[model samples]
Each structure stands twice: as C-alpha cells, then as structure tokens.
Target: MATGWAGDGAVQDQIDATVKDGIQRARSRLPSGPGLSHCEECEAAIPEARRRAIPGVRVCVACQEARDRDAAFCGYNRRGSKDSQLR
Candidate 1:
C-alpha cells in the first residue's frame, strides 16, 4: 500500500517501525540488576515471595504496571518528515 510519496512497501515500513519501537520499549523496561526486597520507587517493602519469584526485579509490581501503562499511552509519532520540518 502506498503512503504519501512512498511506494508499495510503505505500510510494511510503518509496521516494521512500530514493532521495533515496541521491542525497544520492552527492552528498556527490563530490570538491569538483582531484585530488591523493597520498592525502588516508593521504598515499600517488597514481599519476600515476590523477590524470590522474579529475580532481577527492580520496581515493585504496582509501580512497574503503572509505568507500563504510561508508556503504552505515550504512542509514537511518525509524521516527522522533511515537509513537516520545513513548516
């Protein structure tokens, strides 16, 4: 499908870009170090079971879910073409 001046592959390009963006976002959210038995964001004590269950966990489950929701809503902007830049 054509998109703007792009040819048949334009839609595929957009899909690829979107998938790449999602993968990047997921990778960015991954914890880098060992799990803490406390919430990194609020300092609330993380349950001992949680730490054991999810090694390398950084933030508490609640904090992590909230952050993920925020990220999901902050969708990508794909209209940064040269034409837009010139305006």
Candidate 2:
C-alpha cells in the first residue's frame, strides 16, 4: 500500500524513526556502574536499602522525583510532517 507520497512505505519509515529516537533518549539517561552512597544531584546520602534495590542508582528519591518532574516539561518536536510545519 502507498500513502500517495514520494515513497511506498513512508509511514513505516516515520514510525521507525520515532521509535529509534525514543530508544536513544532512554539509553542515554540510564545510570552506569555501581550505585552511589550519596545522591548525585542533592548531595544527600542514598540509603543502603535503596542502593541494594537499585544497583545503579544515582539520585535519591526526593531528588529523583524533582528531576523527573523537570524532565517531564522539556519540549519535543514531533511535528515531522510538512503540513504541521506550515501552521
């Protein structure tokens, strides 16, 4: 099937690109190595229980929640379509 566009599988191509981008972003944020004794962001000591539970933990619970809230508001450019760009 064709979308009447330049390519026969343009829709699939777009979907693949979106998925790849999301995967890349997720991989980049993952923590590396062993868990820290203290929170990287707030300098508070990370609990022993938390370190044991999450092996590669970086931030403590409070700091992680704040960081997540901040990340949620970041802008994304999903309007890859030409029609959306014109508006």
Candidate 3:
C-alpha cells in the first residue's frame, strides 16, 4: 500500500524504471565485434588470455579499473538504509 502522495504501484513502477535504465546502461557499455589486441583507452597490451576470455574486450585491466573507480556507484541501491546510502 502506497502512503503519502504516492499512488498505487508507484513505488514499484519507479523501481522497475530504475532497473530498466540500469540494464540499458550496462548493455550500452558492452563491447561489440572482435576483441582488440591492445586497450582502446591506453593502448596497453590486453593480454592473450583476456581477449580470449572476454570475446570483445576493449580495455586492459588497469584502464578498466581506473574507469571503474571513476564511476564506482551506479545508484542502483537507493532504497537501502541511511548507512548504505552514505557508503
């Protein structure tokens, strides 16, 4: 049961929308076609095993790690407790 100004199923609708958006964002980031020998961002060697493991791998682990650190949170867990939100 929705309280306050929220209509019936409004919270669920918002949650569904958030999940859809996250899925789209993740799908968009995925690499396509053949994998590259070197990282696209830094031009570092991607290592033979990595290219084989991830079919369309684009960036090396170091560059990917940096990118990950830059965008650490995707805001997908906003419904958590205050402490979780802070983290």
Candidate maximizing lDDT? 3
Predicted structure 2: lDDT: 0.77
RMSD for all candidates, in order, please. 5.1, 4.0, 6.0
What is the per-residue lDDT of model 2 for residues 24-64, given as tens digits with 9 covering 90 to 100?
98777777678899998889999999888777999999998
Would you give me the overall lDDT of model 1?
0.74
- Give lDDT tens digits, candidate 3, residues 1-87: 566677888768867877888898888887778999999899999999988877799999999889888986646455666354233
Q: Please list all clashing residue pairs in model 1, or write none if there are none.
A: none
Q: Indicate whether candidate 1 or candidate 3 has the larger lDDT.
A: 3
Which candidate order results from sorting by TM-score in descending order? Answer: 2, 3, 1
Candidate 2 matches the true fold with a TM-score of 0.58
**Model 1: per-residue Cα lDDT over 1-87, one tens digit each:** 465666677667766887898899878866766888788798988888877777788778789888878864665567466455334
TM-score of each: 0.52, 0.58, 0.57
Model 1 CA lDDT for position 31: 70
Each model's lDDT: 0.74, 0.77, 0.80
Segments of candidate 1 deviating more than 4 angstroms: 3-5, 41-55, 66-87
